[model samples]
Target: MDIRRYAPLRAAGASWKDIAAQAGCDWRTAKKYLSPDAPAVPPRATSRAGTVSRLVDPFTDVIDAWLADDPGLLATVIHERLVADYGFTGHYQRIKVYCAEARRRIELESDAQGRPPGLHRRFEVVAGAQAQVDWGDEGCLLVGAGAGKKVYSFHMTLSYSRDPFICFTTSQDLATFFDCHRRAFAHFGGVPATIVYDRTKTVVRRHVAPGRAVPLHPQAAAFAEHYGFAIDVLAAHRPTGKGRVERQVQIGRDHVLSGRRFSSLAELDAAFAAWVPIRRGQVHRTHGEVIAVRAVRDHAALGPLPQFGYAVTETHLRRVGRDALISFAGSSYSVAARAADGRVTKAGQRVEVRVGVEHLEIWRLPVDSPDRTPMLLARHPLAAVRGQMIVDPQHWAELPDGHTRSTTLDITDHAPVAAQQVPGDPTPSSVSGSMVFGESQAALEVMVARRPLAYYDRLAGLAAPPEPATTAETTTSESLVGAA
Candidate 1:
């Protein structure tokens, strides 16, 4: 103790004997205390008996059981459950400390006895042989009214070259799904022999047990047949089967969409299109070749496009309304009252509607004679907004107007016009030689028919005369005409 206190003074040039005299110890004793070989530090036993207990010590078994059940169980959760169930009145810190150590011990033990994770071998295919497809959720990229709408990216990556194509859409419907495929094919200028896909409902009709044949959607099969390619559906829950496109989904989001605000799907797609050139210029880590250069070889090996484009149209049956309108996708589209061949289209008749990406066609097929050709009723651009009514003014041309198909009798059709005329009546030539009496009569009739009868009837009440038998039918026809 004396040497320890006087060490600083001695090192500061103080004499040892003088330091001892100041320390109230003999100079010889001080010298022995300062000896180099003397034991300056005390030694203790290497082991100790258990003297203290932890609050978690009693609950150690319970803690271990919980950790065995769920390795990732939170310490706070354990503490809460322990306090409620076990009557353990301990601070959360004690439980947290114990759980951490217990989890670590359990993890080590589990790792020592656990089986190794499954591993997959890296795969490669020849140029143009294979492509992988996947969809990514971009999560509400649009602004304003569409801000809540989720944006999705459809990705196709050539397995050999790692060349990627992406297009943004708001829907994952079958039409949008295949439309994206068409766009991808056009981007590559040819089609790969096989396209890998997850079991999306658009591609797979229904899921089946493993080791069984997977059923493909009918339109999907037809599309593949037309394009001369095969659909390779990945095994259930195996995203790694199409890892190329799966990885590309994240890559596209990071490289092109990250930190950017897109108000529309087209803007998002354009951003990806602009970044594609840069991506192709860089060397891919797996392939070790510039994507653009490798893509050239891939494109060259691809099969030629078919002579005719596959019709990416979805067909549905819709009944023509009395107004010559059909409802589809929450919008109303006009169909001509008469087909192109002059065959009349009646209300409540079921017509086939072929819906395309940007347009739709209404066809009146011959139900009575299947061999007879289907008549095209109308072709119209799809409505931009839902609940909109897309009308073609010409579709209503054949409705019962005064000049054509009028309920009013045509005097010439029933009898000779000259014989029907009375002798006292003014001659048609006396009125005006250049004027057409038939046209005048039709115009007068149309004007009188437009006058509303409801107001007059409401005013007259019980005094109103008995209505004509055809009044109800006439009213319905007029309403339909007004709607058209």
Candidate 2:
């Protein structure tokens, strides 16, 4: 049967009945074979042309080469090439079939050759059991005029709970490190069973050898001891082991730190304090509850705070001056009078002054003085000074021989001299051009003129001029003062 000849007859619209009768076959056989609905037989064209075997051989290699040059090259190109070069005149769909088979072979080969070598373990964590910690740098800026501020953020996360805490500090020193941890633990309202950390130089010394253990730095060990928790050190350079904190650090930078602007470390800390509560209250997709709620539940499982306080203490080395006082952060405090001429150690939240087996509490010095010197006195002397400073001069009139007017004159005479001598400077002093004293009527007039209207009005409403000094008291004071 010539299918090509039938093609022209089929295109011309000749009925199956007409073709079957002309072909001299039984009507039933003709209808069964020629009807469009009849099952298709294999093409006879290829068999007659004797080209089928060559077209099928090496078909995969041909398709692969064409695809390698351009994976998106059309199947029609291959079909056209086959027709022009190898006399392939089969239907277009036959070429498509070969192309699909070729694609399957290439994919199988790629799977065998390019697949990753080993399986990856999924990350799993226990809720509230452990946490990860890391430090990230934030660049320096002038927080205030003449105030150079450099800040770093301490980041922590509970492994399973994905709860996060961040604290910004001006230093990464041991004290700051401990302070951050203390605040973080308090914020979470409990401590994790274990804390994971990178091999930071602040925490760990150098590794003993590759694949071996490293020693923990003493300060860091003390911090862990204070918190009463064990530390897990990730392998060197393996930050992914502490993936929770690493991810938290990034999120903190984007969501917390970047969203706010601050003018000082204190301001930044305040802003972070406000942000942390909101962050803890946010629902975690995996945990299905807010971090704060989960943390509270876990807190019940945590061990109680130590009977003896183990919280970190700030340490500072200060040199005691000849007056037996040490200066710290622009304030001076007494150690031992003998402690002068040597270095002394101080530690604790309050200034601790060590005087030969005894600890002295340093009183906060007044900021109003021209010289903001911290006054470190023996406890008894401090008590007396406090009593005297607190008592009003007007109230001193009740004391024996303490006439208020004479007392006022004595205080005024000694005020500037006492101020100069307290700072221990003996240099000769002179009043500046701007320094006006009330000794001269002209100077007093200038002072009154310069005084604010409110002050002058308040002074005018006073009951009377301060009682004039008694002549007997003045003559006695003049005689005593002249003797000096």
Looking at model 2, report the run of 10 residues with the lowest lDDT sum.
Answer: 441-450
Error of 1 at 69 (Å): 18
lDDT of 1: 0.80
Residue-level lDDT of model 1, residues 82-195, one tens digit each, is 999999999999988888788778766755445343455678799999999999998988886678888889999999999999999987877888999989999999999999
What ranges in model 2 sit over 4 Å off? 1-121, 145-147, 286-289, 311-337, 340-484
lDDT of 2 at 470: 75
The clash count of every prediction, one per candidate, is 0, 0
- For every candidate, C-alpha RMSD to the true structure in Å: 15.0, 21.7
Q: Candidates' lDDT values, in order?
A: 0.80, 0.59
TM-score of each: 0.59, 0.43
**Residue 59 deviation, candidate 1, in Å?**
20
In candidate 2, clashing pairs total 0
The Cα error of candidate 2 at residue 270, in Å, is: 2.5
